[model samples]
Target chain A: MNNRLKILRAERDWSQATLAVHLDVSRQAVNAIETGKHDPSLPLAFRIARLFDLSIEEIFHDQN
Target chain B: MTKIDATHNLSESAPSSVLRKVLITIIGGLTAVFSIAFLAGYTVAVTEQGGLNAYAIGTIAAGLGLIGLTVFISYKLWPKGTHEAVPAREKKSQHILWAAVVIGVLLGGYMAVASGDNPDGVFSNEPVTASFAVISIATWLIIVPIITWMWWRTIDEHEADAYREGALVSAHVYIFLAPTWWMAARAGWAPQQDPMIVLVIVSIVWSIVWLYRKYA
Candidate 1:
């Protein structure tokens, strides 16, 4: 899965750690999602969407 | 809005990260093997030698007391009403779990060897020394599992994934190792493999891989 997490985070001038703290997760979790090494769970995706004030579809995209 | 292209950099960092993970896992696995084997052997030697002195009793008491104190302190300091990760709390949980495992194994192994009457009288497991049985039962069956559950609950999804992956690798390792080991022993080319030793090895391998994958 590919995500616009990095762009979204950068737009708000938020570091990965900042995003992770706000999301109630580890910085590693945020980095994993951003690097496409891991896809967020449904609840986590929803949390991300809520954090960025955007829909999940707007933030994440299918690679295939 | 212009994209900053942060994702592209992950590819550049990934190979090095993978290599580091592999290296750590290998190192951790080797460390586990040596530590576990040496402890198991030492426990055997101690039991064969027989009588437990004041030093052994004092060491056990002091160690268990210290662990209890540490666990209590960490639990007291745990973040209140917050579901977020607390690194210190998690580390404490890890420490508690390892202490339980190592101590439990050593004590249990010693108790097992010390059990029953020794013809040599180096250490006779008389009726009065039956306390080893109770300690073994409580520590191995009750305390260990309870601490293991507590430790398991403290981890997030990523750590759970790492554990699952590590377990899978260890399980596969056993499937190959045990049968080959049996064949080798049967052929008289190798010493018979101790089930306890093998179990310890599997656990060590799993932990090493799991920890490396989680932290690295």
Candidate 2:
């Protein structure tokens, strides 16, 4: 999975820690997702999308 | 730059994702070394004593030492930036540490009875063979269930998948410690020497194998 989490977070001027707090996850988790090292679960994906007020497809795209 | 903006800038420069692998490796390495040293010392002491009692003390000491080392390392390596990315599995790791402590204390108490060598206490010198037996049974029952519950509750599907992949790469170095600990206690390989030596050898061998695979 590839995500624009970095770009989106950058635009919002939110630190990973701050974003993680909003998402109720550890900062490491947010980093993993942003770097494409990890893919969030459906629930977490929805949470992220909701936080950014964007559709899931806007933040995450299928690499395949 | 404003402090809030500075925080954002720092977050962008080096994201939290990069640190997970590094932290796991460091922690795994530390755990491996600590297990080996403590087990070796324990085995030697047990061999001289010629009983299960010595083995118990050695195990307890090693468990305590590892906990101390973990705390020290965490304090020293306190990473910069927010730590929001911590996986839920980290909670299981913490619980495991507490479980280890509980096991150590219970075992130590049992050993004190088995050896009839209580240094200072009202029960000192009292024959506690039955008490030791009962306690040992109880401890085993409690520890296993607690570990199972913790694993089930804390490890999500994703973390479990990651663990499986990482375990293969590390040649199961991290997983071997628990089994080795159990074997040392249950196996009657050498009654006099602490069986923890077995754990030490296992950790060393695993470490070597992990390094070989990693570097080669």
Candidate 3:
């Protein structure tokens, strides 16, 4: 999965640690998601979507 | 974007940044040297008297080096006030984990000293003493389970997922490897399959997977 998390975070002027705090996840988790190494769970994806006021499809694109 | 890139380049070339990098590299090198020396000392101690003493000395040196590295990394990563926003549960979990590590290190020191020259102590299944057996059994069978439960509860979904994947891979490896080793032992192509060695291999594989998934 590819994500616009890094760009979104940058637009908000938020560091990974700051974004992690907002999402109640570890900084490493945010990094992994941004680097396309791990996909967020449904609830976490929803949280991310809510945080950015955007749909899941807007932030993430399926590789397939 | 160009301004940001220029700023990043300027920061990288700063004297303080250069000094910090140099210090980190030096400390990292020292930590590696201490770790290697600790392992070498342990190997030598196996064939010599006062193995406990050697272990104590090695532990101190390695422990100090590790502590220094950990402190430096934490300082560099968290800065001063950045950690204040960490969730209460996360802070509690970190505390518990640190306490566990301290307890484990203390227990290891006790075992090294108490085991002495008992061939059955550190490496073998044979009981060293009644007290040693009690402590070891209590720590591994009771305390460990409780700590593991707490850890599982405190960790986020990402860590839990990593742990699950590690467990799955480790189980698969054990299933295939154990049967192969058993057949090889029967054919006299290898030594008899030792349960302890199998357990160690499984554990190492599990830990490698877990760390890679969690950190990489």
- TM-score attained by model 3: 0.69
> Pairs clashing in candidate 3?
none
lDDT of each: 0.63, 0.60, 0.69
Q: Per-residue lDDT for B1-216 in model 2, tens only?
A: 876678766666553334443464457544644444455445555656785675587676767677677667766665654444444455555467456655654465445334532233212333556766687677669866777577646654444445445446445553665565566657864334333554455545654443332222
Candidate 2: fraction of native contacts reproduced? 0.29
Off by over 4 Å in 3: B1-90, B118-120
lDDT of 3 by residue, B3-85 (tens): 54543333223323323443544455444444444444454555585445666776666666675675677467432322224
Better of 2 and 3 by DockQ: 3
Ordered from best to worst lDDT, the candidate numbers read 3, 1, 2
For model 2, the TM-score of its B chain against the native B chain is 0.35
Deviation from truth (RMSD, Å), model 2: 10.3
Interface RMSD of 2: 5.5
iRMSD per prediction, in order = 6.3, 5.5, 5.9
- The chain B TM-scores of all candidates, as shown, are 0.49, 0.35, 0.61
